[model samples]
Target: MKEKFNEAAFKERLEAQTSFPTLYPFKFIVPKKSLAELKALFPNRQLVFKDSSKGNYTSVSFQLMVPNSERILEVYRKAATVEGLIAL
Candidate 1:
């Protein structure tokens, strides 16, 4: 079953563990076909990609300098729109 994301708890944890304007890392696993759509979310940002063993999925990772936890949450929210995307 898919787990629900607790935004409030995540926001609290992020605010406590991270300093503002920090370089944050984001990782996501998506179908190979959805790579372009994922990349479009972070234009110009350097992204590292790795293929799953079967080559059907790709792991995309990138870092961004965000001003606050809200910004981090925003990125996740946008990324969630990509079909078959799993954020890590």
Candidate 2:
């Protein structure tokens, strides 16, 4: 069975390393065709993309000033809806 997402553990880790309202960097690896969907998640932010050497996937990274753990968790939750997204 797939283990449920451990949001509490993730929040604890974030709290340890980051201050509130910090510029958090998010990264994801997704199939090339899903780039648009990933971009939709951060409409106003600039997303940096790096194509995999084989060109089947792309690595997307972006930095946004997140207000709190709730917001960060929210973004991840939304991203999880995308097909073949691997949160980094």
Candidate 3:
């Protein structure tokens, strides 16, 4: 089962822990078929990818300098639209 996510609390935590305009890392595991879609979300950013042993999924990771927690949240919100994506 998926754990519940409290957006407000997450935003608060991010604000408390992070400084603005800093490099933030994002990682996700997604089905191979969804790779293109995920890549589209972060055009021009350098993304490191690793294929799963079975070759059905790939782990994608990257970092970007963001203005604030809201920017990070916005990327997550957009990434949520990609099917079978799991953020880590």
Q: How high is each candidate's TM-score?
A: 0.94, 0.89, 0.93
Over 11-65, each residue of candidate 3 has an lDDT whose tens digit, in order, gives: 9999999988899999999999999999998899999999999999999999989
Q: What tens digits encode model 2's per-residue C-alpha lDDT throughout 7-87?
A: 999999999988999998999999998888988877988889999999999999988889998899988999988899999
Model 1 over residues 1-88: C-alpha lDDT tens digits?
9789999999999999988999999999999999999999888989999999999999999989999999999999999999999999
Which candidate number would show the highest TM-score if scored against the true structure? 1
lDDT measured at residue 79 in model 1 versus the true structure, 0 to 100: 96
lDDT of 3 at 29: 96
Span of 10 residues, lowest total lDDT, candidate 2: 38-47
Report every candidate's CA lDDT.
0.95, 0.90, 0.94
Candidate with the larger lDDT of 1 and 2: 1
lDDT of 3 at 25: 97
